[model samples]
Target: MTTKPAIIILSASALAMAARLATELDGEVHGLRKRIGDDAEVTFDDVAAHLVGLFREGRPIVALMAAGAVIRLLAPHLGDKTREPPVIAVAEDGSAVVPLLGGHHGANEMARRIAGLVDGFAAITTVGDIKFGVALDQPPEGWALANPETAKQVMADLVAGASARLEGDAPWLADSALPLSEDGGIALLASDENVNTPVSGLLYRPKRLVLGIGCERGCDPAEVLALAKESLSEAGLSAEAVGLVASIDVKADEAALHHVARHLGCPVRFFDAATLEAEAPRLINPSEIVFSEVGCHGVAEGAALAAVGASGELAAPKRKSRRATCAIGRAPHPFTESDLPGRGRGRLFVVGIGPGSDGWRSPEVSQMVAASTDLVGYSLYLDLLGPLAKGKVRHDFDLGKEEARVRHAMELAGEGRSVALVCSGDAGIYAMATLVFELLDKADGPEGLSDGARRIEIAVSPGISALQAAAARVGAPLGHDFCTISLSDLLTPWEDIKRRVRAAGEGDFVIAFYNPVSKKRRTQLAWARDQLLEHRPASSPVILATNLGREGETIRVVPLGDLNVDDVDMLTVVVVGSSNSSTVATGDGRTWVYTPRGYARKEGTAMTNSFSGDAA
Candidate 1:
């Protein structure tokens, strides 16, 4: 009854008759062969050989076998081959025929063509009658099974002659779509699962899910997935039902997208900024960066809405469902309204002005500062923001005075000013950003001045850390897990510094010495080096960068045993490479640092032994 085309097979004597009939009926005969004659270009033997080879190599094959005894011999020859091309058995007299393997992988179409050759019927076995949904085995090969059991169930239902329904309407879906029926019908859901369907209905929503996130600035995709996963799990959704993923257009070329797509075994679709902007009704509080880039509100709301629409759940009301319960787990970090736009959302951009060069400042950071109304930072940092501070109010203070600066930034932002609290290097690496958050946590601090102050938003943008630039200036001597220690005892005790230095040496971590030897505090650096010598080899490479990237820049690479402690001052950053980090001296007397990639070819037990210590 299906209006699809079919292939027909007939006696060799009847082949001329069938071919002529097909030509007259506006149909063509596509033949197969095992071999090609020298003058013929290709023959029926070549087609048969190609089909057999496809079966042998596990490629999907479409074969039309006549009801004659030839199929019995061919089926056994298909033996031991885990993959078989689809084979449709037809009667030579143009009677009924059924497709066997790789039906959706093009076998059905192939059979239909052949059925016309022999004047037979092609029985397609898939359920959804509209435009037969992709078959279980015929889906893109690399796609992983989000729910193997559900797939199995679908097959069982089909074999039992149950009708299948295609739920949820996606614009990308073909126009011949049909509504899903509740009477034990299978639902063909698009990638996203957010439909407004109620629970207790025959339709079951999947719980195991994946959230695809595309971020502009400041948002880490890894962290976003982690948080979204945690939220879904906490909501009683299984980690498995998340057959859905979400992302913005900017991440179209990101490796992170392929990584997630391959893991979920789902196709990814990107939405333009305008389409997503229409879904921003719920995203009332959007960030300035998000607004400028995505031209909309939060990505989560938009992505979630889009995903739900894809899953055929958009028209269904949000209600409890009973097919299965997926738990939504607690998130490591929760998004707040302040994380939205225009809310006392002050961000701490820890910029690593590489080598203190103007060319190294990122254009994005420049735009952020230009958009700010106030700047909170040390006097040195105030100078760094000079170009962008033409119209902005500057709350500059002295060095070693961070509490006041953090307080003022929060206060200004509380009054609705977009503030940028600056740090010299990466704000997170023992810089001003961490201190700001620590103060923000205190109930009595400036961050908690009033209830109106609660919505102040905060963020940290990574910059070039002092150690990275210092290492590049000297040599590649810092190629291991390294610990940085500030020698100043102003806030931390000297005894603690000595203990940490010894621990770093014992653990074989490369040590980046910060605030190493100030003019007034010369002995601390010597004492720290002495502590390191107790656990590390004396021949370790010790690199010192003085006035790095400034007018009086001096980078020195020396052995740990020959380090001159007195030569180092607060402006100097000292790096002592670990034992694993090798030092090679070039012909020009320059030494470089190098670290091995650990194990490369080891497999099985040998690989286990290599990482066993870390596992413990």
Candidate 2:
């Protein structure tokens, strides 16, 4: 997958140009913290460190700075040209654009694209691009080079005044400035087959072949892979020519199908049963058994025909192994992922974006949100995503529609779209992860999860929870054993909430109260505080954390006896210290709370042992 570029700016002066580029390229803006304002999506404290990090993440970098500066910053990290992403430098005033590295691997093209947007000059320095207006080693989209090592010598020979012969159709090469002749010194062969070309020639594989697959639930990955390879070998087709691995949507999460795609180094796509059934007339081996099983007459043949469209033909008929079937289809022209009709395996990422700050959000959560096609959550939670939410199809729900939000996300993923079910804090805590599973467990009864929904791959990415954020803001109130209880009587009965609070007091465990209070539910906080006071002293510390990581953030420590319900709200998390917890006033005039974990007893024992040894 191609990642969106990171437009890095150093000062506010470049913010305007960076914004324009970001919009044009569909990229994100990263700026220096103090120099740039809120217009920049992300802020960085260090430039070199940030650039290196983006480079390592394999994200293209478009720095609106001097070319020399970017070159110097990325010099040490420049080793593998093949593995590096495009790095471009654009003049802050939008006058000049330079491709600093990865010239063949998209840097040159990106620089030219930016220059076009700014009406500036793209400083393309690659000799192949300048001479023939094409890079043989780095073919355009929908084409793969079989022998890249031969490109360097061939280009050298061409530069030394050698003519080339075109074996097959390739408009980009034929239209270039390359000197072509019927019987030239070098041959450029473009074919979808695994052919034996001349030693001095270049073999280019056009992406016109589709590998359609079908397998049992627990089919061995090796068996599927071997069958696919054997089918391609018999058809005289190259693996590099395989554009897509397609199957029924019901097998979206099948391990064997994914393994086949990975082995062929191609993306896997899926078609709904109804869509596949439409291609049943064209199937070479349509079966009624398959129609009864999956609502499709043929899994392999029908999927292959659907991918190739009406103008194409099957290169190979259905070939079956022990538990898997494979078929190949050839399209009239090369295609990309966007040209296909169906989607890939759907993925539902239940992600926790952390409290609110970008710093607190986990990198894994950021990556998942970035990769998702749609975002589903409460409006406030989706808004907290900030720049990460840009360009995504958002499905916002009201505060009270938790079940509706999860159901919508699951259904969206069932349609072969990548959906992110957004949540606050850790998703597995009291968030939507549990609700998602609950609905899935009851799929047969009331929730009625579709087969496609059940087949989607589900994952949970943990985030920094509210309890951890509150404890970090304060001292070590959670240093000892602790338990969390929700004081909201809406879900659980008031008697049950009070019982848990009383049990926590009897156990002398530090308690963190979630959903502490609402407008109509103010008495629960006060009641919990009174119950905890009966066991611990009235002077025990209680930390009230409101808007933990967002605006109007406040952290206050008060005596348990002085805690009032008016000071708490639904947004506040109340943490009451245990009986052994103590508050100490440090030299900095800050009061820190901590509970002893019995380390003092170990220290005293060690001292007594040393004294006894001295006396003996």
Candidate of highest lDDT: 2
Q: Which ten residues in a row have the lowest lDDT in candidate 2?
A: 607-616
Clashes of each: 66, 0
lDDT of each: 0.52, 0.88
The local lDDT score (0 to 100) that residue 195 gets in candidate 2 is: 95
Cα lDDT tens digits for candidate 1, 404-463: 777777667655567777776676776777766676567475545433233454555666
Candidate 2 regions with alpha-carbon error over 4 angstroms: 584-588, 595-597, 604-616
RMSD of 1: 20.8
**After best superposition, candidate 1 residue 86: deviation in angstroms?**
54
Question: Largest TM-score belongs to which candidate?
Answer: 2
lDDT of 2 by residue, 1-616 (tens): 3388999999888888898999999898999987875567777888999999999888999999999999999999988888899999999877899999888889999999999999999999899888888888899889999998899999999988999999999988999999899989899999999898669989999998898899999999999999999999999899899988889988888999888888877788888899999998888899999999999999998888888889988999999999999999998888775686568778899999889788788878888998899999999999999888988999999998999899899989988889999999999988999999988898888658888788788999999989999999878889889999998887799999889999999999999999998878778888888888789887778889999999999998887888888888789998888877777666776767777775546745431101111111
